[model samples]
Target: MDIRQRLATNLRRLRLEKGWSQEEFADQAGIHRTYVSDIERGARNPTITVVERLARPLGMSPSELLA
Candidate 1:
């Protein structure tokens, strides 16, 4: 899969592993729920800063998310 798809898949897997719904994950990630949904759907191209924001609560690096 492409990088965006990889990111989406990894993000969803990690979030589910943490037992956090999109809204809960978004709250922890300090972003909007819809933004989390967009990322999980591979429908958004988030910035590096945003990726960092996403990675933090998941105990991951941005590269890990993209990997």
Candidate 2:
């Protein structure tokens, strides 16, 4: 898959593993719930910094999220 798709898949998988809904995951990631939904849907092209923020709560690195 493409990087966006990879990120979306990984993000969703990790979030599910943590038992957090999209809203809960967004709260933990310090981003908007809609943004999280967008990312999970591969509908947003977030910056590297935002990727880092998303990864932080899941104990991952941005690269992991994009992998």
Candidate 3:
């Protein structure tokens, strides 16, 4: 899969593994729920800053998620 797809898949997996709903994940990441949904659906190309914000709460690094 492409990077966007991979990112979405990984994000969903991590969130589910932590028993978090989209809203919960979004809150923890300090982002809007709609934006989180867009990311999870692979409909948005997040900037580096956004990626870092997401990765921090997911207990991962931006590079790790990108990889």
Candidate 4:
């Protein structure tokens, strides 16, 4: 898969693993739920900064999210 797809897949998996909804994940990540949805759908190409923001709540690094 491409990076966007990889990111989306990993994000979804991590969120599910943590038993969090998009809103919950977004709240913890300090981002908008809509943005989280966009990322999960692979419709948003997040910057490294955004990745960092999201990764923090997931207990992972941006590179791990990319993986």
Candidate 5:
């Protein structure tokens, strides 16, 4: 999968693994819920800073999240 697809899959997996709703995950990640939805749908090209924000609450690095 490409990076967008990778991010969507990984983000969904991570969020579900944490038993968090998109809204809940977004709140934790300090981003808007719609942004989380867009990311999960592979429709958003999040910036590195946004990736870092998403990663931090998940206890992972941005690179790891991309991986």
Candidate 6:
């Protein structure tokens, strides 16, 4: 899969592993819930800053998120 697909898969897997609902994850990530949905769906081309926001709550680096 491509980076977007990889991110979508990893993000969903990580979020589920954390037992966090999308809304809850979004809150913890300091991002919008809908945006998180879009990201999980591989529909959003998140910038580095937004990737950082997501990575922080997941206890990983942005590169990890992409990986």
Instruction: Tell me the TM-score of model 2.
Output: 0.96
Q: Which residue pairs in candidate 4 collide?
A: none
Model 1 / residue 59 / CA error / Å: 0.8
Model-by-model lDDT, in order?
Answer: 0.93, 0.93, 0.93, 0.95, 0.94, 0.95
Q: What is the lDDT of candidate 4?
A: 0.95
- Local accuracy of candidate 4 as per-residue lDDT tens digits, 1-67: 9999999999999999999999999999999999999999999999999999989998889999898
Model 6, 50: alpha-carbon shift in Å? 0.4
- Which residue pairs does candidate 2 place in steric collision? none
Report how far residue 47 has shifted in candidate 5, in Å. Answer: 0.3
State TM-scores per candidate. Answer: 0.95, 0.96, 0.95, 0.97, 0.97, 0.96
lDDT of 3 by residue, 1-67 (tens): 9999999999999999999999999999999999999999999999999999999998999999888
Q: Give the per-residue lDDT digits (tens) of candidate 6, residues 1-67.
A: 9998899999999999999999999999999999999999999999999999999999999998898
Backbone clashes for every candidate come to 0, 0, 0, 0, 0, 0
Tens-place lDDT per residue, model 1, 1-67, is 9878888999999999999999999999999999999999999988999999999999989988888
Model 4, residue 36: C-alpha shift (Å): 0.3
Model 3 alpha-carbon drift over 4 Å, by segment: none
lDDT digits (tens) for residues 2-39 of candidate 2? 89989999999989998999999999989999999999
How many clashing pairs in candidate 4? 0
Model 6 steric clash pairs: none
The runs of at least 3 residues in candidate 6 whose Cα sits more than 4 Å from the true structure, single-residue gaps closed, are none
